[model samples]
Target: MINAGIIGASGYTGGELMRLLLNHSEVNIVAATSRKLAGEAVTDTHRHLKGFLDLGFQNLTPEEIKSACDVVFVAVPHGTAMDIVPELLDDDVKVIDLSADYRLKTAAFEEAYAMEHRDPRDAVYGLVELHPEVAEQNFIANPGCYPTGATLAAAPLAKAGVISSVIFDSKSGITGAGINPSPVSHYPNMAENVQAYKLTTHRHVAEFVQELNRLDNSLTNISFTPHVVPSIRGILTTAHVFTKEKMDVDGVRKLYEDMYRDKPFVRVLDGSPSLGGVRGSNFCDIGFEVDERNNRIVVVSAIDNLVKGASGQAIQNMNMMCGFDETKGLWSAAAAP
Candidate 1:
């Protein structure tokens, strides 16, 4: 069994890592760390994992985790992970960071996140579908939740080199905000409300551009806007792709199908993609249509923001980096109504 450890284990993502790792057949969770909850039963914070996990949260140092775990997941907040991840590397242990720290180049990261990067190192951007080369690396920077859904929605068109520009509009569950309660997360304010923030300046946009630009360098006209819905787990992204050439429905369908055929987690849906179809699963369900009159194709993609968007994807990276079957634990069906 691959011995794994989770650092910063008191939040939504950390709890999710434990919940999902319990389902992984070949994994043995060794340590789960949390400064505030040190020595507390993990179940206190992650009640869903009560019966399955009996470990207590630790305030272990990096050397302690690296010595005990074969693989480590750094799930701390953006600025915080930069400090922890560097210490976890340089050993036999493989590391996957679920924060924004190592996802971008130093300059871009500093610009987008507005923090100086202390550890400037290279990490494979772990979008397993697009960058399968992560299998050869010891360190991976898991893509951000918003970027995971948004980029996958438009990647096929961008890779086909058929689109001149695209705009992504995404709605995520409140959990995307994290485990903490904000004024926006208040029940009175959040219920029956659709909140849109970071209109033209969300940091995840840089990630969207960074990943797509890898496919087609000249494809630079990308825009993104995010909204928070009243839902609990999924992100639904609608991508308006303006094509340079006229695209038909059949052709657009073929593009998405061909691109995702070998990617185990991405489903090219015959009907519309909905949050329900991909909730609580690592699958990315995509559907699209062509607007011949506007030289545009609208593609929609859905994923559980906490699963395919965060923890499950981090496990997917671990699976690849360890040479395990990509779908060994994640091939299950979504929890749909």
Candidate 2:
């Protein structure tokens, strides 16, 4: 079995990673690190994993991690991961970063994140469906939550080179903010309200643009807007895709079905996808319709932000990197009402 370690095991993404990895048939989680929670039971922070995991958090050094783990998952924050990942990559150990540190080109990352990238090495962007070549690399940079859904929604059209412009309006659960609490995540303000932030300049836009532009270099009118809903998980993206040439609903459906036919995690649904259908699962459910009159197609995509958007996708990359079955530990159905 592959021995794995998780860095920064106290946050939402970290906890989610632990939960998923605990059930992974081909992996054995050896070390989970958290400076603040060192010596404490992992269940203390991740109560949902109490019975499944009996391990405690450790404050292991880079040498300890390199010696004990064959693979390391960097679940720390963006700027923080850049500091830790360089040391972890010194050996032959595989590294899958669940941060934006290595997801973009060096210059684009620096500009979008507004921080200098200290270790700017090439890493496969771990959007498994779009780029399965992650199986060939030792390092992978996981895609952001918003970008995962938004990019999947429009990639077929973009690849067909029929898109004139695409606008992504995404609504995500509050958990996307992280475990930390702030005024933006406060219950009183968020409960009955829908708040839209980073209307035109969310950092994740860089990822969507980068992936789509790779498919069609002439496509430059991509725009994205992000909002926070009161729920605790999932991201639902509604993409308004305007095409250069008119296409009917059957043609659009055929495109999506053909693109996702072999991808295990992406489901091309018969109707619109919802949060409840994909909650707690590693699935990205997509549904769309064509508006013949306007020459536009509205595609909706849904995924559990903490799962498909982060940790679950991280493990998917790990599986591919390790040459194990891609669905080895991720075949469970979504939790629904």
Clashing pairs in 2: none
Q: What's the CA RMSD for each of the models? A: 0.8, 0.9
What TM-score does candidate 1 get on C-alpha atoms? 0.99
Model 1 C-alpha lDDT per residue in residues 1-337, reported as the tens digit of each score: 9899999989999999898899899999999999999989999889989789999999999999999999999999889988988788875999999999999989889999998999988789999999989999999999999999888989988899998999999999999999999987888899999999999999998899899999999998999999999998899999999999998888888888898889999988876799989888999998887889999888899999999999999999999999999987888898988
* lDDT accuracy of residue 119 in candidate 2: 87
| True-structure lDDT of candidate 2 | 0.93
Q: Provide the overall lDDT of each model, using Cα atoms, as 2-decimal numbers.
A: 0.92, 0.93
lDDT tens digits, residues 118-169, model 2?
9888789999999979989988999999999999999999999999999999
Looking at candidate 1, what is the lDDT of residue 14? 93
Residue 282's lDDT within candidate 2 is 98
Error of 2 at 75 (Å): 0.5
Cα-based lDDT at residue 106, candidate 2: 95
